[model samples]
Target chain A: MCESIPKTMKAIVFHGPHDVSTEIRETPKIEKADDVILKVKYSGLCGTDLHSYRGHIKGPVDQIIGHEFLGEIVAKGSDISDSEFKIGDDVLSTFTIQCGICWYCKHGYSGQCDKTNTFGKVGLPGGQAEYVRIPYAKSTLIKKPASQDHADDSVYVLMADIFITGYYGVKKIVDFLGQKPAVGVQQLEIKDATILQYMVLAPLGVGPVGLCALRVLNHLGFKKVVCVDNVPSRLEEAKRLGAYKTINFETEPTLLKEVIEKDTGNVGFDAVLEVVGASAALKTAYDSVRRNGFISSLGMGHEPLPFNGLDCYLKNINISFGRCHVWSLFPEALEIFETLKGDFASFIDHKVSLDESKEAFELFDQHKVSKVVFDLTL
Target chain B: MCESIPKTMKAIVFHGPHDVSTEIRETPKIEKADDVILKVKYSGLCGTDLHSYRGHIKGPVDQIIGHEFLGEIVAKGSDISDSEFKIGDDVLSTFTIQCGICWYCKHGYSGQCDKTNTFGKVGLPGGQAEYVRIPYAKSTLIKKPASQDHADDSVYVLMADIFITGYYGVKKIVDFLGQKPAVGVQQLEIKDATILQYMVLAPLGVGPVGLCALRVLNHLGFKKVVCVDNVPSRLEEAKRLGAYKTINFETEPTLLKEVIEKDTGNVGFDAVLEVVGASAALKTAYDSVRRNGFISSLGMGHEPLPFNGLDCYLKNINISFGRCHVWSLFPEALEIFETLKGDFASFIDHKVSLDESKEAFELFDQHKVSKVVFDLTL
Candidate 1:
């Protein structure tokens, strides 16, 4: 493993806004007892990186800026045993390094762990490089199953964040719908579930996460979902991803009302899955849910609370909000990802090499490309 | 039943701010086919009625104002049947008259029913009046069980609002704790529950509702609960009602932090029952709760939402907010009320006749009395 490792690696580095460039940098090494160095094979450019790029979310410059990455584990620290994670094994990095022993993690809220650190920020260089060091490897890395080894980058890259996130939102929705995971089954699937018996569901924002939510619902054979988004192409993608119906929020504003009246008999959706981290989307969700309805939100917006306390109470709303506990939901999401591989294949619209980071970021930032991945193996 | 009724009755009527006068008003008769006249035997002066008295909540004056009342059903409409409900049976009034046929009612969100009306406003004269007319009587009135008939007005008056609201908050908290109702049990009890495994809990506001929460938690053998309030007398009442510990919010500002660190080991309470509707109380709840904590709020506040969306999202809070669906929770709440009769009997601090309305209302509004009720039988 050491002989194959390099002294320097070519990688994309972040400077100021829209200023990502390929530079030869010292390859990341195991810096901690729990650290593991992965030879990056593929890494996806995430929406959050755009926040850092646009300076919307302040962060240190000249750092690596990618979160969704998976590769061959080339090296590890002394504390990492072969049985836990070994050299030459394929693994995916978790978006955040969360201490699994914290109260939040123990209680199924790993995203809010007491000791948590996100990759691609501060000294934690991201996966957008030839070699990246991942601390807390036991909790941060997911080994590829022998059955899923052939899935490759386009499919498994999502195993890191968005896939788990979208599925986590769906899990919360399913929980809110009062349907528990069937006895003896660890995955989140409605047992003996029939579409006729299900409640009306509306998933706002047809981004990658929203698309995944629709797919998971579809896989579970749910047929009452209506997806909303302002982007037309994404709306089309939403429909393809098994959205029972799609509505463009920019045009046909009456579509939601029509759906609410016709589908729910004027009562709003039984639950609203909000993944768009914008106040407008939240307001729409608030207006579109029935009283005592559930809103499962995974949005990361910093806007002031959209709904007034009086309205929230009057509506009798039940809301489950937060970043998804990706580690906790990974297995279930991976199962769904494996099942929906064919449908999610189109998700990675661009696969550029490390040198094309500038063009890829520009296209993704402008929404010219639906999704982009850096193909380090190229 | 009609032969036993009278044309005129003595009642306490709300005329203006701080003015409730005893008046000889015409007795209410059944108007709707489903309506029933509950001969007011005893009625509790609720916090909401105080809102109506001060004109804080706009409503017509000269209307009787009391929602928590139970009495023998003296008369009924033509559609009445024995199996459903009948005259001569003792029944308790629900806080709101919700139509059981609506979608909201069918889906466990009865509080937001499309066709719903509250007593003590407009044509729906409240339970403070003798021979008060109740619409949608089947869903608005709860018949007292023969087993519970020995438990009279004071214990049962709470059955109408605070008792159910507080219990509802606990029910939400229990549900948020991921404990499901045991099979074959319709009530919300943690079957085979153990105090050693229960999460640290904090119930803010030692009012009647908060006190009920403490009592119910105690009934279920939950030990790690702390009750908070600014009122010293209510705090004492809370302890007697089964609060494991009490904190005077105005005095022991450090008490919460101490409990958080000492009791919860600084992780914060797993679940916070926020019964006080004020913004300050909500802020306190938000601050006191743990990351990924569950906040079950039944407070009816019109204050602007006190939480920012970003903060709420980051904390991963699960909030169940709204008026308790009193009619829906009647049987369960009644069961607990019977079980805790001795503890809840002291809830009513003042009981007087129709002529003492002025004193009762003034005392209750000024916090001179913890609770008050008009005993028409007196």
Candidate 2:
């Protein structure tokens, strides 16, 4: 446990697109009233990290790059007095932090908060360093289960972003409260009948969001997680994370019909999650869902969504696309990780030290790793 | 009353696409015990009737032509002794005569019944004749309210088609009973807290279905019904039917967004009904609806729906499409027309004699009339 601040820390900073290097910089300090300084233990590379590495994100250099992370609190702000979080508390941080008292936060939509903050961006130095600063610490940090070992925490690291995003997708359709009966074409009279039963999961551009959807479905008790991807490794990883089935569109272009028939006996899914931002993937997700089904998109593909409004209207389908409030659902995701211990970390197949940032980034860029975890013990 | 079987009757028979000639034909005899003979008092020309006239539908050149009609029952089968109707009761006939015990009929979806016997089609003689045979009379006929004058009954002709169609669209989204709160986006809970308020009504292609939605909303007590259309006449009809505002898409390509903002204060609609089967109109309905809103489409536009599955899954939208079951909701519509006679018939604007079928067909084809009532009384 550290009482005084350290002077220097080793970190990987993104200078520009495709230009990532190791540097010795001043250790991050606890600045905001609700901020906490965490001694970075583990940071995972995600697809967005790839996007940033490729210079797709509109931003400046010198942003400590990385969003998915598990760490230990090194220091707490003056206002933070959580009994559960001490200087040595092993915890994970949500990628986006919310104050949790705003209008969106009150509505459980902290992901869309007005004053929300994201990690590893220009404004926020993320967990790519030994010392990482976390804003809205009370709402963003979750303590690891005391019973599980550190290696077990890697699978649950997705609680920071991906898993919660998937759960939020499913929650929108079916009322989780488990009341009222399901509605069909025949029982149109049973008003207020929620038809959120079918789901579509488009892991279009594979990475964390796709895998996170698989992990979250398993954690949330969904037996069948339909995973769509062109890459075989990611599909294999999805399978291991308990995806009911994986359809490689590279082989089966008619995957939508297969998935539809498999679950709904030829109707269509009730919900679909498009993790890829490509226009084609978006269209496929919309077509695959049946009458009254819901679709959730987490990828930030910058192209204007080629929205077919009239078709969507006729199908009675609903669609919403944008960024997520990672801060709001972080707690529930943490609870899922804590409760479901063994399976969460299975997605992380490669582990490396902070000094090997170049090697880790290369493996990630080449799609050679499921999840490249940085062991900050160095 | 003595009943005598007739060998022939005056009938309007079709010779070709543009030609209809009056011919003397054998009067339709009751074949089934469930059939009733109606002495045709009035018949109406529908857009589909014109479609049939233009050689759009596959039928014999010499087949009978009209479907929409009002009549007085002159003969009943031996098995029909229901007190609901007698030998001289005036009634309106639904286009399709459905057997009540069939799978679709028993479930109250007689419109989709596999064995539906449609009038004026290849297998049946039509109501354009002086006397028409109706099968399953108890299920398909609605006795005209004794309070209204016979001339004013033309207004109720729509009950056979558009009125019931619109009511079905509204009933699909809102709870009409008032005992159950309308189940829609407003009632959806975000995560574990928060309730969304407000809804959207995106009506694509303001045809009969769209106008029907506007009328039903008035009956259902919705203050704001956002109407979308390209034709000025349809938009005008929409306004007359109580739409809060109408957006003509032909004038503004992004009319969907404008209608959504105008009606919902920019949040989007809670529920939308897509009446136009065009792919673009479907997309418009999709774009205008807010997160978790309901979109129900009743249009039969033929085209592969350009669907975005991921967006729908995440947003938790509900979509239902295809033909509406008129028989299931006809009773409700009949009640509206019976109780609100003067108010309901304001939408009917055209009346013509049987010999003027060509003129009526022309007006309907040219969009010169909303409804053309064929006075068979000639």
Candidate 3:
């Protein structure tokens, strides 16, 4: 796979707020016994990566900036074994890794593990680079479908972040209060459990997280996936993906409440997923859910939205805030994706060569793509 | 029992903001068949009564303000039958009366019944006078203990309002979602059930409501009752009543965090009682409890406290608000009070004659008394 031992590899790094540039950096090395080296074949730029680019949410400046990726394992540490994986195996590694023995991992909260390590920004070098080292390799990497060619990375790569995140985020609704996955069933034993038969996804920003939420809800037989967003393109995309209804925030300033009450008998929506990391979206998500309903906010906002304690007490709603643990859910999410193989590939809106990485980020910064893939072989 | 029928009995009227005076008016005639006349033997003043007196909370200017009381049933209307109650019987009536047929009553929330009526500030002539009319007599009046004399009105009257209010407040933790009380176990044969183990009672202002909460909790065997109040005097009362912990907002500004982390193990309290009608206290009760916890607020607040919808949604909390359904729980509460007997009198901090009623209001208004009892016969 190596053409030569180069001094550096092409990567997209944030120069400062609102600026991203392509630069050369030495290929990352596996530093620990549990580490594996992988050559990134496809990487998707996310809204959070854009936030990092804009310096909205704090992170390391000048750090490698993409997280969603599919790649091939090229090397392994001495302590690594091939029980389920081998060098040269095509796979998707989540942005995060958990040792499976942590307080968070043992409790099924691998996303919040005290010892969690992420790929992009604030951790070992990210997948934006040509070669990246993955720690706790077994916990992070999920083998791609055996029938697929290496060139088909776009179809399965999302199992790395977006797809699994949506699945994991909903799973968290049941997992947050329980000791294990089994215990989550116990949590639902709460009496007068208000039944949430309808769900609304707020501010459907043009990204995989929101779409994956819609896709998964559809797959689970939720007949109505109300989409709320001002942008016509995103709303259209949502409708195309089988959303039962779409509300343009421009036409309906109170779209969230209007849609929720209309569908859920003038009370509230059963569950609301805040995919857009905006204060207004967060507030809408909070206000539109029914009593004892669930809200999962996957996007981290720039500032802490002001909270009203009295209404919260009076309404008795539940709000969960955290990053997604794609690693913990890849197996199931990948199974779903592989079952519908080529259908998932349509999520890729653009493909760019490593040499065009800078322009790809610029387009992403300008809201030009939903999913952008970096083609290493180009 | 009939004294000369004065055109008016001695009445306390709220002329304007904080302007209260005792004046005599015609004793109100019972025009409805469901109504009964009670000779107010021992009427208690509550913080909500003070609210009406001070005009902090709005009520009719000429309204006679007393809701909590124990008295003698001197007269009954044609529709009254002594199935569970009778005339010449010493009894206590709740501030509210449920028709026992409305959706609310059928659902066990007798407080919010469609035909329910309230005495005192809520569009009814209160018991501050020598007699007051109680509608829906069968559901509103509870016969006093057979072994007790009329002199026990000081404590027995509290059971009609404050004590039962506190008792039913804990009913919010009854696992109602798991199984209805009237329903059999065979109906809920599902093996999986989430049981609640802890409850948090946040009494915003420590007056009668908070104290009654302590007395009721002490009777129900709930070992962890955390009383939250802004006043040191109220906290002292909470401590004396055997509260597991008292969160003093004046002392600890981060009272919510402390209460949740310490008492709730950082998840949240099982049931939160917003006894204090203050907006801030309502807010604390909401923020301190965990997901799936119960929030029950009694009476109205001066201003609407905006709620935190997201936080509540993530936690699966449920909010219920209304006046106490004193009759629904009076039988059990009377049993508890009977068991306490003379000991329940500790709640009576001040006992005054009918002539000293003005002074009683002043002490209750100044927060000097936990409960003020008016002895008319003296």
On lDDT, the candidate that comes out on top is 1
Ranking by lDDT: 1, 2, 3
Docking class of 3: incorrect
Q: Cα RMSD to native, each candidate?
A: 4.9, 6.9, 8.3
Enumerate residue pairs that collide in model 1. Answer: A309-B305
Query: Which candidate number has the best DockQ?
Result: 1
Classify candidate 2 by CAPRI docking class.
Answer: incorrect
- Find the 10 residues in a row with the least total lDDT in model 3 chain B: B179-188
Give model 1's docking category: acceptable
Instruction: State residue B158's C-alpha deviation in candidate 1, in Å.
Output: 0.8
- Candidate 1: what lDDT? 0.79
Task: Give per-model TM-scores.
Answer: 0.94, 0.70, 0.68
* Strongest candidate by TM-score: 1
The C-alpha lDDT values of all candidates are 0.79, 0.67, 0.65
Per-residue CA lDDT of model 1 for A1-378, tens digit only, reads 478898999888889877888899999888888889999888999988888788787765988878899899999999889989889998887888876666665555678878888888887888889999988888788887665345555567777888888888887777666632111101223333355445545578888888888888777767778998889998898777767778987798899999888877888887889987789888898899888878988898788877777887889888988898887667667767877877787889899999898899999999999889999877
Q: Ranking by DockQ, best first?
A: 1, 2, 3
